[model samples]
Target: MPYKPTVVLSAIEEHHSDGVFTHTTVSRARAAMVRAVQAIYPLYFETMSRPPIEVSDLMARDGEKVTVLVHRHNNLFRTPQLIAVEGRIITTAKATPLGLIIKGHRNRGIALAPTELVDAVPGWGETAISALRARCEAVRALLPRETAPLTAGAISAIPDDTADAASCTTVLLTSTQLPYEDPVHGCLWLVSDRTPGSGEDILNGVLLAPPTSSLVSEHGSIYAGQLPPYTAHLPTAAALTYAEALDLAGAINGKDPSRGYLSALARLDAQL
Candidate 1:
């Protein structure tokens, strides 16, 4: 069988009668959900754990008795090596009254059933998990070729203190805007591949430039949350770890090391 793409699906089902996705609330909720998927994916992939297929819901008529039903689906493995977990965050008073409940069914294999009723939007949880899964799929597709020895781009130097002393290096992530506040001095820089062509060649091109003095960089700006910048100029295998590649770009840029130098070192160390 062809290898299926590994995914981590998280869905949030909201039982909000209000019918409104509040900007502030949704943003914060989404962030939290993304964080959960990020934390869970690594664990799931590292240790293969597959839970039995189950379905349950908190019914308002139950009057605090949360009811859930689970049935093992045939051909379960068809869904990729991905984690598809979802939850309903009901803002209504009904969801809050029932708390969480677990019940076993005789029809199914008779495994311990578990369910929870939380006070939040279910869609937030679902979307966050889905986002992580989708991102993982995308990254897998974007895996760089291993044939080439990763190269660094020419490093550009920027003055530490601009004419106004409020000077800072403008870290650009390809075309994205990843503005770093303060960069470290005389340190390495890192960046991610945003443009077409080989990431190594692009990095090498940036590194070949004159040394930069600014302490700001924007390596992981495009995928800011997922991929962050790293310190450049460290002795690590090129094209190995994602963090290292990013840091290598920083070193090549060298336009603003003061800020990203230490980060690069840490990222490189993580590769070990």
Candidate 2:
């Protein structure tokens, strides 16, 4: 799959009948496959105990705003749709009033993203067969369908830089809609949370170390697919002092303890 493991799944399914389709199969294998790839590459999420966005499901939501993750959608250049060329080269594509302008590496070769299928020329075009189509067909002939869901992988071998950081894993005091650039964990952070609903009494807390807890900076903004909610753009402890964090959070919501979660984050502020 030249495009992406996920995108390759989409392309192969669109043209060839041999591909992953079963919900349970995809569900079981997705994290494992993702984790395998993640072992080689640094995955955004510290843990992935969830389902992935299927391309078939994405096709269902035709025009609505959906998070388009190309190679994880970690770094999108303003435009959601970028160019994926053959020959192991990935460039970019931006829509102009005229048409989609595709540019090669360093803007060396420029071309229009072809709307219709033709001889592929490192430009955007519909393809009946993906790079994985032949390999997929061969693999299907070799393996049993039952084995698809049986595949599994591990992240135990993957190095953890935060090995020394105390796993102050505590209550689910908060859950952010968008990810902040974690200083220690990189992008797409999932801070430890614990929420127990079995009893009436609830004890809630979160892991907040001054070194790895805060966002990259307060001046900068990050985008997943489109603009995240205003609340997602939170202040980082590195960018502001503890007093500033408390003041800003209090000023926003003005609630008792619910005045934006920044007051709690003030503990992580290394400045002042």
Candidate 3:
């Protein structure tokens, strides 16, 4: 005889008033029933001193009510290993040529008479399964998005006083906008002189110049600062040049880029 993986057979009947079953409904019902059983049985076993009572011992005596069983197997060295076991209850004890048939929620299966069955939890029946399924579905519906959105933040320097600042030419740059592209090498210029129209003058300059005298002449209205222009929509190549120029200028002024532009760049890199 071929060895069949041990399956537990119960003697319970699931009756539908409509007496109709569809493939989809039956599959769903079986899954729900299994989930219900799995959830309840663990808690029920935890209450016992020696939980998961063995199937052989539970089936030794007749008329003993059992809801779950712990199926045990032996390894190569004969060490007992516990494996997951499922049991079903049949509705009738009639001796048919195949075996006794058991019906679960929207499903049925055949099992032999005098089957080795054990119970783990009492009152574990189709009604309990249905109730548990409903509760699980309700809880699932209340959950938020399957995955949460990612968030990020950063802190950098900004100008403390815009008017009449004699100490430093530029203050730290701080903005919520992210710099997606590298700044133009030598073209990244900022004006911290607090001139009447310095902001507009800085904005008008062409980005990423090759550090020529004409480039400075074009935007000579305001004194240039070491900080890079952080305005959006600059091309990547230009942004790179500006970033390099900002770093060089910062180095020449003996100011650590981390105190300003470097910090902002680090935050953007983290997001990526």
Candidate 4:
């Protein structure tokens, strides 16, 4: 019933496997929201090919159960708009023993019937195919991404980056020791290639990583792979992609940009 909120909510739902509350600043999730609106509400809203500047304020106006709160180190950066379509978007392909699918994506795939099952249940494949076809037909009705005008309010909605930067207070009790958890710590990067607020293609990034030892950034880094200066406990400036950030964050650490930034803030808040 609700237009914009549904779109926004759907986009957030698409990427979340763990069913957690998502923030407005996540660009990847927001991009998915952009795509969700296009797919679901095509007639009223043109399936935008480009992302917009301010979907945040729109939700506040639109009738939806929206909540507001601020974290210590609040930021809403977006990852790229990859994987818009879910495993629900099915395709026919050959699956292999090596867990690879050929010709088509077999992500979250299903086989009509295994060889023995087809033999044991003669009409099973036909019945399964028929049902799947109907389901896919229903899916075809909804699917699509893109643009809206830039609003002045949207510009204002962006937090005062200068103030946030100025508030960077990393108290080093001992100058000889790096304050952050050694071997790995927090980081953020300014990826100009990404869409700012309304960008479907881009969002800025946050990271919790050790000094860049071996990880390589997708767009590379302003500091190559080394740690940036004066970033001991504050989010420092650099260039990196979500994947690259995650890589540097390592397999054990969490990879969420929003949560990552919050954690960075929480750590610094203790000293203050």
Question: Model 3 reaches what TM-score against the true structure?
Answer: 0.19
Off by over 4 Å in 1: 1-82, 90-132, 139-272
Residue-level lDDT tens digits of model 3 in 164-185: 4322222122111125632222
List runs of model 4 lying over 4 Å from the truth.
Answer: 1-94, 97-165, 168-272
Query: Which stretches of candidate 3 lie above 4 Å from their native place?
Result: 1-33, 36-40, 47-50, 63-272
| lDDT, each prediction | 0.28, 0.25, 0.28, 0.26
Give the lowest summed-lDDT range of ten residues in model 3. 147-156
**TM-score of model 4 vs. true structure:** 0.19
Tens-digit lDDT string for candidate 1 (169-272): 22222111226632222222233233333231122112211122332333322222222222222233132334445445556456543223333323333432
| Candidate 2 structure quality by residue, lDDT tens digits, 199-233 | 32122122221112333222121222221111121
Model 3 error, position 210 (Å):
64
TM-score, one value per model: 0.19, 0.21, 0.19, 0.19
Q: What is the lDDT of residue 48 in candidate 4?
A: 34
CA lDDT for candidate 1? 0.28
